[model samples]
Target chain A: MNTRFILVLLFLFLFMPCPSQAEMGMGISGRTEALVIEQFPYVYEGRFSIHNTSDTACLYVLAVASPYEDVTEWVAVSPAAVEIASNGYADIKYTIAAPGGYTGDYDIRIIANGYALSGEGTTGDRPVSYLQTSGSLRISVNVTHNAGDASLGTTRPHEADAPAAEDPQPVDVGSQAYLDVPTDVSVGTAVRLRGGIIGHEAPASLCIVLSSPMGESYALPTDYTYTFREEGVWTARLTLPDAPLVERQIRVRPVRAAGMAGGAYAVAGGLLLLGFLALHRERKKGQKRREKSEARHQTTLSSISLKSKTLEGREMPKGL
Target chain B: MYQKTRITALIAILALLTIPFVWADSESVSATAGINPYAPSFEYVEITDTELSISSHLDVDREYYLHVHSIDKNGITDIASLVCTLFFAGDGSLSAGATDTRSCYTLTYTYANGTANWTSAPAGHLVEGDCSATPDGYRSRFIFAFSLGKIAIPSGDTNTWKVSVTIMDRSGQTTTYADLPFDVNDYIEWSGVPSTLELSSTCMDPESPWTLPQSQPVQAVVTSNVPVSVLFCGADLMYGADAIACETFTLETVATPAGGTVNTAYAIPGAIPTESVTLVDTAYGTACMLDPTLAGYCNNSAGIASFVIDAATGATVPYVPAGTYSAVWTFTLERGAGVTP
Candidate 1:
């Protein structure tokens, strides 16, 4: 019976939580958990969540022993990972850069250093006590290439509407695009300028500007301009002048014009009114001339008849 | 029955005699070398700087050659060498695809007076680096990394150093040594930091000293406007206690800067301060020096050292060792923005 009693006392001593001896009741509290992460082929980044579940406020930190000398103790926990304040609970997260193609494993221990108080009746008026605990978790990760929706070139399920062309967005250039011009054009050779807005289908007219290498500028007419109606493709052709063909710079701008049809209507209307007035005057003159001619013919006929009466009927029928 | 008893008694005695010998020899660090009794030949040695620290590795092969281009704060590799060991003093030099035991040789880096021979000597390859502040801003210091080829020291006797090292030049005659200190079979790692760098003599033990798991602080007045935090700091391994262990230290910014950043450099304090050197090959009677101080000199002269030879002969027979050597080195500052208060 004595041996059994001794055994019970030993068990209690080993398992019982230790209490803080300081008057301020400041001591360690909460539990610590370990994260065992496997390495990846490329740079691998991940975050570890540190949950605080203590009655009193506490601070938690992570300590790592690296083979590298550059790594040191008390590496400041990233502020973005966790929130810590006086007398408050928070979670700490760490975005750690795993060693490239790491074939080995390491231990990361979380230290929970804080203080709290026990219930008034729990420990013979010693209400304040420090609590500390720890747990560990292992992650065996296999490095892999995950071709998700974005990687497969499929639009995200909840993507917003694409922005307009005027927005200052960076666009990827095609491999075939180049800015090469002839050093010496046999004057009058038509050179082409190609520029385009990506992902848009519209007839785009680019204004081409030619400048000499010596900073001299001259304006070229756009009378022979052509537009590209295909999306993401703009081309403009221009005949080079005899001078400044060698080492010249060319620039193109897109032009958008509004209210261009109103002037054409006014000119067509005025031409139609003029044609109507000329036709009306010609009709009136023709009518008056026809009446006069008819009257004269009738009078001649009458005279001929009277004469015929005198000369008897001999030439009268013939003359009539 | 009498014959059987006698055989059993004889067997028991033999077993008793062998037991003590086996136990005595079991606890030795050295092995009765397996197939080839001699140490393996080093084909080459490569040095590189990783995100963690600077390290060196040895390649076990037949032939090796390395060129050291430059050395600065980044890492040092300005002097390279192509070492060849004439086994038995030309008894069994390396030939095309020969796999005979007689052709094999060994080399090592011997230690004495608390420092290794290659490390303490003045004329040997000495690559240094430093980071300093300039008017422009923080910039990385330059360092040279190198790879060199197969040359082993003949390992017939204990007195003969088992190392044959040769410093190959672009034009000058090659510097060759047949016997050297330190075992060629074992590799050495050299690295350091500028402030308060210590070479621990205990590092002669390969396994114990190679990895520095402890941290040492630099004793310098805070010069920067801000409470300067040293991000990446390194130094060349000092002789004596610290032999062959490269140490790197990094610190984060806990407080703000309070002063201007200071330029920190790691150099052999007692080295001669001449800026240029000229190497003369005796047979050709031609003198070549990449001297920046002289007219029509090369611009980026870092490791240009002069060695006056009696004569320059295209043949190895006419080769004589010139005593003096020099190299071009540059110092620059790093992390100015972090240093600003």
Candidate 2:
């Protein structure tokens, strides 16, 4: 019975969990679970809390690791070592800074390992002996450059429609009569002039006149005789020279001659029209003479008949 | 045999009991760096009306603001110093007594609460400092003003430099961060050339009766550190040589205030007397000269000279083709004129 009891006790001792293993089950928690760091030259800070779930007091060490070895220089974890009472918690801080001109993303891991303090110690300091529980925290830092200008992201509002072109409203320039002269005209070319008597009936003696650049005036015909001798922008006026009290003014631009002359096309068209009319007149005259001859023939035929009848009557019967 | 078995079992049990104690005694506590999920980010460097403060890259003749942070878990009480050094390519070291090798910095310790100010050193060096902490953590801030005017590079050339930062805590723990590379470049530059030159229009009709001499302005702009001259060569629509001379066009140079020195030189052979002048310069300067006789140098003062191409009746204008022509203006800069790389 004694041997059996001893064996049972030994089995129980071998199967029992280790003190460090029990402490290792404790969890480490952080106020900031994940981190995203900006590119170098920018500072990033993070905070974490380690919870000692087990009844045993624990000592912990903080270690940081990254695939980017250069990050170690820019990053730091404070309170590299810590002591916490059983079922108590402690806070850890880490700061990372990106070097100037550094940009991109980085993945870093922070690990907290808890060790069960064997002997009783105060909260201030304790001798760390064995590994108990370990927990890991993950963070990401993305570094970027700030935009130089704020106006770049803003959009301009849509614009309203533009105003329409101004109408050509006529203005009274203290004139009794005025000519509607074209704004553009060719030098040495005839241009039509249209006029209306303002505030009165048509002036009987009104005649259109054109003045050259040299101040030389020439009277124009009713049909088409207004001409300019020089190439320039000139003004035309409807003059009532006999009635000097009427005041009127008109202006037009007579530009230099461009391309082919307009008169050539006009002359060619007129000649074609005259030829067509003359041909039609000749055909009508010939038809009228033919009709007159036919009528005379008919008249002659009647006279002959009448003569024959008279002879017959005079000559008497079959003997004549 | 029974006694030996019992003894073996007892030793095994003893070893098992001691195993837990040994493991517990050896394990040590450790803390890991944590991550912050919500971090601020920007896409470009910040610029202010008065200055350019931050940038992702370095440019020659531009200012940049560099900020660094130092944090300690134990709560930073005092900082011994902070220093930054720059190393160029091809040996990774700055020359002895080179003032541009290192730039000092100023430190500002901001507690987690966000209230902060800075203490600056007369030079670029950073000295001992202290920091305060809030509910967040303890932090030391370092700021530096950096520029790239210390080095000379060729046009269209780029060079890389490495920067390193070293910091020390009051406890004598020295930490260094290094291997940050920056690129510097020089851009190619040229000035005083007009975007386009327009010539006079000619009548399409060969039988046009109205004939008076028609002329158009021809000008050349010169901006150079070295003596330079310009030659205007004309060709027909098919690039036929001697088209301007065959057309009997003349080039007359007109001196203006913008044109520091003016002369006329004729490069075309078998051309009639058209006023042309040429000049020589003993020093570097810009010279505008019109020479229909020969291609020669003008005075050495930077300026622009105006010229007129006289078009006679039935004669083609210089640099103007019958329909469309190409004008080739050759600009030559003298060698060894003190142009810096």
Best by lDDT: 2
Model 2's A-chain: what TM-score? 0.34
Off by over 4 Å in 2: A1-320, B1-69, B74-83, B87-89, B95-160, B168-186, B191-193, B197-341
lDDT of 1 by residue, A187-234 (tens): 233443322211222123322344443444434442223222222212
Query: Which has the greatest TM-score?
Result: 2
User: What's the distance in Å from true for residue A46, model 2?
Assistant: 38
Query: How high is the CA lDDT of each candidate model?
Result: 0.25, 0.40
lDDT of 1 at B61: 20
* Model 2's DockQ score: 0.00
Which residue window of length 10 is worst by lDDT in model 2 chain A? Answer: A120-129
Q: What is the per-residue lDDT of model 2 for residues A1-320, given as tens digits with 9 covering 90 to 100?
A: 45754664565455443322232223433322234333234577766556555555555556565544454456677776666776565667888765542344555656554444432111111111111133445565544433111212122222331112221111211122333444445666665554434333445666666666667776653224465457653545444553221112323334523322334444444554455456656766766777778788878887888888887668678764
Q: After superposition, how far is residue B315 of candidate 1 from its true place, in Å?
A: 72
lDDT of 1 by residue, B42-127 (tens): 23323233232323222212122222222222111222223323222222232212111222232222223433222212111222
Tell me the lDDT of model 1 at A293: 80
